[model samples]
Target: MLDASGYTVISGPVGSYLAERLAAAIASRNRWNGCVWLRRPQRNLRSLDAALAEACAKRWRADTHPTDDPRRRLERALLGSPEGAVVVVEVTDLTTAIGRLMTGLRPLASDRGVRLVVVAEGLRLPVVRFAPDALVAPAALGGVDGLAARVGLLASAPVAARRLTRLAERRPAVATDLLDAAAVWPHDVLLGALAGRTRTLERVTAALLDLCTPAQRSALETCATTGYWHPQLDTGVVRAADLRPWLVPLEESWSWVRPIWLAPLRRALARRGPSPVVARPAAAGPGSPDDRRLRPPDDRRSRSTGDQGSRSSEDQGSRWTGRGVVEVRLFGGFEVRVDGVVVDFPGRRGRSVLRFLLTRPDRRCPRDQLLEEFWPDVDGRAARNRLQVAVSGLRSALRSATNDHVIEYASGEYRIAPAVRVRTDVEEFEEALGAARSAGRPDVALSAYHQAIDLYRGDFAADVPYESWTLLPRESLRLRYLDALDAAGRIALRTGRIDDCVVTAHRVLEVDPCREDAHRLLMRCYARQGRPHQARRQYELCRRLLAATLSVEPAPETTALYRSIRPR
Candidate 1:
């Protein structure tokens, strides 16, 4: 196993037998501090509470304190265990509870240094199926890296192991096929086929497809098309399918049945080409505002439960979140709005903490990481206490809009769970910048750039300009804003929008007073506006800025542009 073996998938012809043995083999080794085997209960535990009671059974409980959330209890359990301790969760019972399960597990992989080894019959897991925040590492068991450990596990089931080994000995390719299929399909199916006990790939896939009802087929198509399934999309089909032993809930809302066999099924379903399982939204008509789907999302993210909380409305973009409607505008100034109404957070440091978390790409900042980032000058104990206080103040203020748990704590990290619809101008600005760059057509690109420019009213977190947390994104957005200005200026000039060009170039200089490109664009816009002296004055400003800033003459291009615009 890799050093940080957060997740390992074991699958092959005898994958089920091997999965159990793999756990057993690890159990045999006395090197670990502790181990928890997560098998389906010997007795029935139908509800999640029941299942957790069974899964957790006497493993984690503080002598002085008791916690109810299974996720928290598991974290406490793992924290109490020493390094190299293992938890083997049976996929069969836990597939439907993927989100709750991953919410507990994913944070631990990073914060606790724990390794979760999942033994499944195939590549399908609840994590892959849902496409939630994926774990850091994903390794296949039949693959080369962990081969020795898996080889020893084969002895647990002599008959299946011996038969598979014999088949591999004769064909040799059987071993290769077994690994390949194990990556995507069930190990048993691959083993049966390679052992000449089943049909060809096409028929094997078709047989699997035949087993799926239309609803199941549709669900497979959706996850395949979208790359992950979200349970919030909880249709009758998806919900029913989720309960089955075959469905594995991955990280967040990802889904997979036999991802390896999906390609052939997709091909068979659409022999013509890439036919999306769901119909795409029609393009906006001429004179229409650019659709958020077609552009970077400047608007608030959709709160659609129908699509499983994934923001992307199309084939591959976005995760729809629940109800964080408290929008924080970080552009011109800092303003927290709940449902479009302005509200102030309780204390001074509360805004800083919220700003830091809002700026983080993943939104999960460990308590220690936050201390290092925001309070490097303070003592560790003091900083941690300060953070706790600030968290309380922030949550207190946000409690009216969100619950007291809007700022959530788990596994040594605190993250925002601010209702369902939370939006930040900074996040939207970055998204717009990306959309502008990725837009295919020049017009589309120009439109996106213009939209991005409009969204960026001022520098990022202008109120907290000097904060360490604000500097990186602030500068990044500043550079991107400059680029958008330059691009938009050119587009305006080319399209005969001279006034817009002048405004855009002037705005560029407002941000970076020495930008020769902006100076050149202004010179042209001024010359085109028949303001020759103004054009010449723009060149003089560029020359002086170069001399003052860099102590050197303006570039040859600037001088050449100045000469071109001389009053004549």
Candidate 2:
């Protein structure tokens, strides 16, 4: 049912056993790709949690976006799932669940084919009006007597009850077969194959002798003989014996037969080749941790493939120049230096505008888009005027250092000109990270990563909430930076640079205290560094923060790390 549809909702009290039963039923049905939405925070590590954990360990991808409200989480889950993917949501109470039902009904109703399953303690008809195609009452699981009693509660007449009982008894195997058939090929092929496999001389003769019109079975025999498995094939009567000869000519002419047979062989041959492996650099010393935490995210690293001309010293318009170049450094803080003398860029908005353009130099940003981002709450006219002023100030600032126009306004768009030598700390950080990722020496990679961290001043484009355009990239870069730090810290610990790992992990915790991996890594680092007390402290802090914020305990892996570090 879930596979045929795209969504399902399961609601019941916490620890009510319904979630596990439903999950087991879904898994037994083999809907491997369906996602189960975990709503109740208190129910973690219970039967349902264990079931989900097992499911994920079996190669299913799972992502958790912790939220306080079940309703909001449900909305986000629905929005996030890829189109046509099954969604199983667990709700704790009938009242709250029914509220969600009403809100979600419109969207679910629009997709008439999607399935909705609601589970609760009792099979009492829900006041919320959703007529499910099938209902399973848990009380029926007791025995034949219990099942009879539950069946009696339904309004179905005695005749219908007996019919349903018989059908229910026969349905499981048929459902299994149908699932198996669905797995093998398209529905039409399954139908054709089943028909062909069942056709016999006795059945054919019986139909012919009975003077009955040829059934779909005859057409299946014709198709099997003709090798025409397509749904568009003519449905005409043909003897089963005649099919083999007709199929011979058609099989040879079919275009897809060769490729279909060759695919697995081709894949097998491809797998025989040696897998390519990337060699990473050695880990850094203890100091490396601070460096990794301090660095900007690696994605914003510079990708300039060519050398740019430096700011020229000959022109009086040049701000300051040496070696015919002006170097703009973006690490830690934004700075443009000509011959080592810093050129001052005026105004906050001007600086922001310049930084925004320089971040993705040469990429055009439409005027309206820029205005909306940089000053979203301001009126259109006021925003445009502010943008104009910012741009003018930025241009004037650039003019102080060089004859070249750094920022260009053209074709109803704004962009930094290619010739401007813009050196960004974020770009440098990313480049270092890339080098580290590719380095043959872990120490070298660690050093590069450290340098990258030194370049980060604060959050990317900090104090720019009005700029909605930058929020996604900003958050993405922030997470990447944190991940890279964790990776570097792990490498440091592995290489016996315990002090460095400790510092690095601590830096990460400063930015995000809830990072369990960083906490665990730091604990290990402290243990190796002979600071058992510090390790214990880190564990305690993690326990406190996780409990307070998420209302959950640290994962077993984290607990194990702490136990390993505790003094004997």
All candidates' lDDT scores?
Answer: 0.56, 0.48
- What's model 2's lDDT at 516? 97
lDDT of 2 by residue, 408-484 (tens): 88888898676654455567668867877897877667766655554454567665655565677678778878877
Give the number of the best model, judged by lDDT. Answer: 1
Task: Assess every candidate by TM-score.
Answer: 0.44, 0.42
Candidate 1 wrongly placed segments (more than 4 Å): 1-323
Candidate 2 lDDT for residue 182? 38
